[model samples]
Target: MDAIILQVLNGLDKGGAYALIALGLTLVFGTLGVVNFAHGALFMLGAFCAVTFKKIITLEQIVLSKTELSPWGTPLEIRTPYAQQWFGDFGNVLIEYSVPFSLLLAIPVMLFIGIAMERGIIKHFYKRPHAEQILVTFGLAIVLQEIVKAFFGANPNPQPIPQIFMGAADLGVMVGMAENVITYPKWRLVYLFFSLGVIAAVFAFLRFTTFGLVVRAGMSDRETVSMLGINIDKRFTIMFGIAAVVAGLAGVMYTPILPPDYTLGMDFLVLSFIVVVVGGMGSLPGAVLAGFMLGVVQSLASMTEVKDIIPGIDQIIIYLIAVIILLVRPRGLLGKRGVMEN
Candidate 1:
């Protein structure tokens, strides 16, 4: 029972990532009708944002110590992070919580990048062939990847979770189980809740706001919405930005779990795309649903009992299910009729 609960929590953690990335992909495709292969790069960029923030705050000042000397050396060097020196306890707190604090930097940066990408490049491909869209966006993704490599190098940079979030929580006690039976990382739990909050916020934005109403209307009938004297194109572009923000924030939060690297985006890109397809090409709810379902299945498949029964089941389970889902539901689990028909 404890094992089952642990795996479920793990599944939810993984699902949070999958849902965020897939949600952004679905948003772009639904609103713009453009296949964006470079969306994963936004996620990579967000992780880098956290990395950059940590680096900036931890910039060190080196000075020769007058009172201390190294063996066979004239003076010992002392180094202190600028943040700690400048802010004292507050700066120390900032450094300790750099990961969450990075959101401030990531949000605006991602928003700008998303808007610029859409306005500068994606808008031109709105009416182009899907193949062309894929090729061009893939090329753009490679370009972004190379640029990141040039700056940050190929090595993965680890980001530390806040001290407060460090260590595992005994969830078993809360659930009326034996003490310490179901321990889970506090950070992972925080991530799960954070992802849920973001997903809910996006849904609320689209369902409750006037802009969301028009966007939903545009998604249904683009020409009619335009004919009604609405600038659907502009709104769609903003939606693209919002999608980028979602992907970026996901990447940012994920840094503590998976170290930031240039290839980080590429690694998750394929899985997320599979998620979008299985969920339904443009269905937001379906994406979230499929993400969590697949995550749980994959987690359960990794168990020793399951792996013993089926060799390497964990690695192939997700792909196998994708194939099965496609075969059974041509338009995906929640895909609307006539979507992607053109």
Candidate 2:
């Protein structure tokens, strides 16, 4: 029973990330009818944003000290972060929580990148063939990855979680299991709640606000929204920015759990697409539901006994389920008839 609980927790942790990325992908595809292969790059950029902020916060200048000297040197050179010189305790705390603070930095940066991509490149491909869109965007994704590799290198860069949430919480005691029988990372728990809050906020923005109502209406019937003088083109562009922010934020929050490399975006891209397909393209609820469901399925499939029986079931569990779902419901679990049928 305790093992089951642990597996469920792990699944939810992985599922939250899948749902977040898939939600953003569905948004762009559903809203603009453009196939964006570069969405995952935006996610990678978000992780790098955190890295950049950390570098900036810890910028150090060498200073020669008169009183201190090295064994073989005439004078000692001291390195100190500018933040430390400018602000003492607060700066330390800021660096200590840089992962969370990166959210603020990521929002504006992602918005700019998204708008730029939309206006400069994606804008021209709106009415083009999906193949063309995919080719161009995939090229863009590769370019972004190469740029990151050039600057940050191809190796994974680790980001620190806040000291406050570093250790594991004993769920065993809290849930009436044997003492120390179940433990999970506190940061993972924080991440789960944070993801839920972000998802809820996004849905509320789309469902309860006028901007969202207009956007939803546009998604359903763009000609009518435009005919009504809603300027949905501009709104859709903004929605693109929002989608980028969504992906970026997910990447930002994920750095502590998964150290990011240049290829990180490509790694999640296919899996997120699979989630979107299984959830029913353009279906937000379906994406979220499928994400969690697949997560649990994956967790169960990864058990040693199951793997022993099936021999690599864990590796193909998601794809297997996706195949099964698509076979049964061709349009996806909750997909509307007209969506992506062409």
Candidate 3:
């Protein structure tokens, strides 16, 4: 029972990430009817945004102290004690307090990147066939990845949990498991709740607001929305930005768990697609539910007994489930008949 509980918690964390990314993918596919193969790149960009912000936060202006004379009588330059104290000892010391600060810095930058991609690149491919769109987006993804590599290098960067959130909490007492407390990392728990809050806010915005209504109506029927003089194109561009921000924010919070890496976004791309498909494209509730469901299933597959019974079971579990779901329901669990039809 204790083990099962722990597995459940692990699954929720993984699900949170999958759900967030899948939600963005669904938005693009549902709203624009554009198969955004580059979305994983956006996710990658979001994760790298954390790395960029962290780098910027830790940057220090280099100042030279001219207290000593050189051999040619020029003053010698050395770093000041203040610099050492502020930055820490030795080579390439960081501010040690920059990870959290990255959150704010990453948002606007990511927003702009999202808008730029939508307006500059994605805009041109709207009317193209799915094959062309996929080819271009895939090519764009490679270009984006290469760009990130050029700027940030190819190595994975470390993103540690803040000093304050370095430990785990025991939740056994709350659940009547006095001797079997559920241990959870503080940062991860925070991320789980934060993700939930963001998702709720997104749903609420869409559910109660006119803007959301228009967007939903557009998703359901784009021509009608345009006929109603809603400037559907503009709204969709904004929606693209919103989707980017969501993925970026997910990347921002996910840094502590996986750390920010150039390839991190691509690593989860296939799984995210599966989640969207299984949830039924354009079905927000289904996306959310499937994200958590698959997350839990994948986590459970990691058990030692399960591993012993079937080698590589953990990895294929989610994909297997997706296959089963698709086979069972051609339109996916909650997909509409004409949602993705030509």
Per-model TM-score on C-alpha atoms: 0.97, 0.95, 0.88
The better-scoring model by lDDT among 1 and 3 is 1
**Which of the two, 2 or 3, has more lDDT?**
2
Error of 3 at 17 (Å): 0.5
- Taken over the whole model, the C-alpha lDDT of each candidate is 0.92, 0.90, 0.81
Candidates sorted by TM-score, best first: 1, 2, 3
Top candidate by lDDT: 1
List ranges where model 2 is wrong by over 4 Å: 68-77
| lDDT rank order | 1, 2, 3
lDDT of 3 by residue, 215-315 (tens): 99998888988998889899888888888888888888888788666677678788898999899988888888888889989999999878999999998
lDDT of 1 by residue, 1-342 (tens): 779879989999899999999999999999998888998899999999999999999999999999999897779989999999989999999899999999989999999999999999888997898999999999999999999999999999999999889999999899798898999999999999999999999999999999999999999999999999999999998999999999999999999999989999998888899899989999999899888888888899999989999999899999998899888886778888778633
Instruction: Tell me the lDDT of model 3 at 82.
Output: 47
**Which stretches in model 1 have alpha-carbon errors above 4 Å?**
71-74
Q: In model 3, which residue pairs have backbone atoms overlapping below 3 Å? A: none
The 10 consecutive residues of candidate 1 with the worst lDDT sum are: 333-342
Quote the lDDT for 8 in model 1: 89
In model 2, residue pairs whose N, Cα or C atoms come closer than 3 Å (at least 3 residues apart or on different chains), thus clashing, are none
Model 3 lowest lDDT segment of ten: 90-99
